[model samples]
Target: MADRATMERIWEAHTAGEFVAQDVEATMDDDPIVVHVPTAMGGSGYDGVKDFYARWFIGRNPDDFTVRSISRTVGDDSLVDEMIVSFTHDIEVPWVLPGLAPTGQQVRIPVIAVVDFRGPRVRSERIYWDQTAVLARRRSC
Candidate 1:
């Protein structure tokens, strides 16, 4: 089972925008880790996962971005986190909306993440959100 402390640290790093390859390496198992995101924005394996973070997530800089936790459920080897993610769309984020330019709109969306762990390290993470809500907000902007 994964250690709650380690998982918390990983989540904290991600929210703080301080997550890096080293963090991934430290918190995740050496084996390939599966990552799933909305709209097929995900990858498997260590390198693939790293590339996804570099290109889609960590690379982009949003204005006033924040992720606040609403609730959490922990199990023997799994953890589920319900969160509110808010950010201003002042920069291009192709992963979230492909071929769409920045609309300079503020968005608040609920997100859920299911994390699976192997021992003290993470094995996989699946994240879900309402893409339609984000798109609608962008359209209105």
Candidate 2:
């Protein structure tokens, strides 16, 4: 089981978009860490995870990106967070919507992330969201 403080720190960093490579290296086990996002946009292992973050996450420049937690649960070796993520689509995000150009719209979507921990380190993170809601919001804007 991982400590609550450590989990809080990790979540805080992620919400703030401050979770960098060093944070991943320090919080994840030496073994491969699996990351799964919406629309089959993620990968397994440290290198694969790093690449996804670099290309899909860190590389983008969304205006006013923020995550607001709706609920959180902690288990023996896992944590689940339900959140509302909001951002303005002022720049292209290929990972979120491949080949789709920016629509200059704002979107707010509910998201859930299930994180499994190996002792004090993270083992995997599976994130879920509705793609249709995102697309609908974009079109409505």
Q: Whose lDDT is greatest here?
A: 1
Give a tens-digit lDDT track for model 1, residues 1-141: 546776676555544542233245556556545454667876688888777767776756575877789999887777899998787888887667767887888878898988787777667778888888778878987
Candidate 2 lDDT score relative to the true structure: 0.70
lDDT of 1 at 124: 79
Residue clash pairs of candidate 2:
none
lDDT by residue (tens digit), candidate 2, 1-141: 668877767656544543232245556655645444667877678788777766776647575867788999987778899988777878887656656688877767888889887777777878888887777767776
Return the TM-score for each candidate structure: 0.84, 0.83
For candidate 2, the TM-score is 0.83
Tell me how far the alpha carbon of residue 26 in candidate 1 is from the true structure, in angstroms, after superposition.
2.1
Q: Any runs in candidate 1 off by more than 4 Å, and if so which?
A: 3-6, 13-23, 34-36
